[model samples]
Target: MRLRGRKGIREDLEQQQDLVVLNPEAYKGKWRERFNNDYPIHVEFGMGKGRFISQMSVKNQQVNYIGFDMYDELVRRAAEKTRIAWNEAELGDPTTIQLALANIENIEDIFAPGEIERVYLNFSDPWPKKKHGRRRLTHPRFLEKYCRLLNTQGQIHFKTDSETLFEFSINSFADYGLQMTNISLNLHRDGINEEHVMTEYESKFMGKGMRIHRCEVLVGQDALQEYQKSRLDKY
Candidate 1:
């Protein structure tokens, strides 16, 4: 859910070079250098207003987090959230969090192969139209990109309120031959724990009595080879 543009959003985002990255592609494989440490890196795709990634960054101070969103307006809001968290922050160097603006289509271009440790897909756009299946984040095409971007131990954590999309993704991952584990049909049934961080969409859905589905897909070199050998474009 993208927000309507507010006045001065672009200017404010431009001024947030410390916390927001507009030219993210330039960093590419050099993200570790940007963070100035060897901490493992995790990224949240489509981070709406940055609730999940911001909290995760502070909670897991040992890991670096990058939140990517297509909207400058949302990026600005996420940066604002990070700033507030920085003030009240006790554990981590809030600098460990960097929000960026990027589209999912060219995501492979923004990072070099074997650069990311984990990728989070939280409440991503469903792109439910049959013709737009390629646009779904869980599509085999994007999964291929993530496979190249992640190290051998890299994994993707995904959550959604759309059962249709969730089932589609399950089939997609299975057909792609990528190993999936920790599948959850109703994630909050046990209630969110210290390790669980809710996104803006997830919080709203909870208020409306909606169920959240989640799953984890592991990335491996062997799986990458298998995915490259076959095609599931029909998905």
Candidate 2:
């Protein structure tokens, strides 16, 4: 886990947001004002380096996107890509996409009640140890956080190459009473689905002949309560 010299990369990230801190706490319930749009806000938790979100934002100008990643170095790299997009006139506008350094577990602090429209959990870290199961992005605890942030009928689109995490997520979704839709075991076999955005990790993993697992779970008030109850039982 020894990462080489990347301090300059982190410094680059700091430079990108020199004028403002993209901490979620500062913007918390004011997402609408931040983007100056009433459109639904979709977020990608653990945006590796922002490749996926940047490309998606450029392709779809109507949807507002917020990418939250914990690593400062990673956020900086992603922010650099975003800066490039903003500079290019032919790339359309991505003023809707905001990058933030924040923990995914703190969704309440990052988003107001029912403010998020969709969540993309792409190639998230799979805490393999059984004791670390709760830390998994698809765990009930994390799912509850996402459920609370999402608007009624909001959806979570998840893509991962890990079968263990995918199974864990599917069970969590069904157990929590969320409607699971469009479950796919192999993404590339489906003829390059437009809805499926590829992350940096996804590109590398899929290149090695891996099967990408994906699913969409719809969130509602009723589902939120059920998710909360299930998470409570775990404690």
Candidate 3:
């Protein structure tokens, strides 16, 4: 996870106003308005290099997508890839896809409650250590935040190559009272679904004879409330 310095990456991203939202906070609750459409907003957290989001936005034009990453260089590269895809598809409007540089811990600052319809966690950092368990994206704290940000019946799709992390995520989702489905232990070896958009990590791992794990979690009003109650009880 060592990031190489990219010269002028920030300046370049700032210039791509149509692709990267430099001031994401300005459109916090009004993300759909920025797209000029009421399409459901889907976000991919930790969208490294942006390969999956770019392809998904092109394939599903009806759903608006926002890719969030902590690094400006990675976000810039994602914007570049998305722009190329849009151009190849001959789509004049690039509003369907947007990139943002932000930390997942402060996600609430960038998105309002119930503003997002779906979340995608692709190959996220596992933070694999007993002391770092809380840092895992699927931890109860993060799941609670996701519940607040998602609309009723919102869904989260997570894919990973780490079996330990995958197991932990499954348990995390269950502990948070989120409903889970579409579980797969070996995504590619079992079968590649039509809706599956191969991520950069997925491709690389599969090439190395590694199996990918995938699952979908649904959050309802009751689930959110239950998670909140559990947090309150802990205090």
Candidate 4:
């Protein structure tokens, strides 16, 4: 999707800088302190319009949620959605949701080791070319970064509409030695409809009769080490 420049996008983002971490580099290892709570930090990478993260934060006040996207315009829109959601939900503290403009390729620079409890990859780019396999969010390189950022029991919850990407991600996770569970080829058809926050892409795709694939993988130190060794062996 080509992103057209939005008017006043810069100014809009500046106005919500308090709610969005414009300088994520400064918070790097101290994200928990920024939230002013030890509540488990959950992040949604590629949080396009922010519907899922905003709703998730509103519903689960105990968890601190951060939504990351590469575009300022997208982050600004997400911040607005979060603010509106907080007001409608009548939450006392709206600090539960934090938006950030950062590229996923450098996620390590934004988060510290063991700082995040969970990570969500919702409708991420497939990077469908074989030559672009390494660029996929579920690729071994990206998974390595996620592993370092996640705590002992941290898990990745991934949802996608692309079957090819889903299958590739499953193999990637297995190759990295991550333990997978709650695997569903067609999420909505699996009789697990409750508590599922629908994202814009998810709603559109599912409404068009496209099945959404979902999976959860637990990160472990052993898996990380094995993945690292495999990478070394490729040299």
**Candidate 2 wrongly placed segments (more than 4 Å):** 1-5, 8-11, 18-21, 85-89, 221-235
Better of 2 and 3 by TM-score: 3
TM-score of each: 0.90, 0.85, 0.91, 0.91
Clashes of each: 0, 0, 0, 0
Q: Candidate 1: worst 10 consecutive residues by lDDT?
A: 222-231
CA displacement after TM-score superposition, residue 205 of candidate 3 (Å): 0.5
lDDT of each: 0.87, 0.79, 0.89, 0.88
Model 2 Cα shift for residue 144 (angstroms):
1.2
lDDT for 21 (candidate 1): 91
Please, what are the lDDT tens digits per residue for candidate 4 over residues 132-157? 99888999999999998998758899
Q: What range of 10 consecutive residues in model 3 has the weakest lDDT sum?
A: 220-229
| lDDT over C-alpha atoms for residue 164 of model 4 | 99
lDDT winner between 2 and 4, please give it: 4
Point out where model 1 deviates above 4 Å: 91-93, 221-235
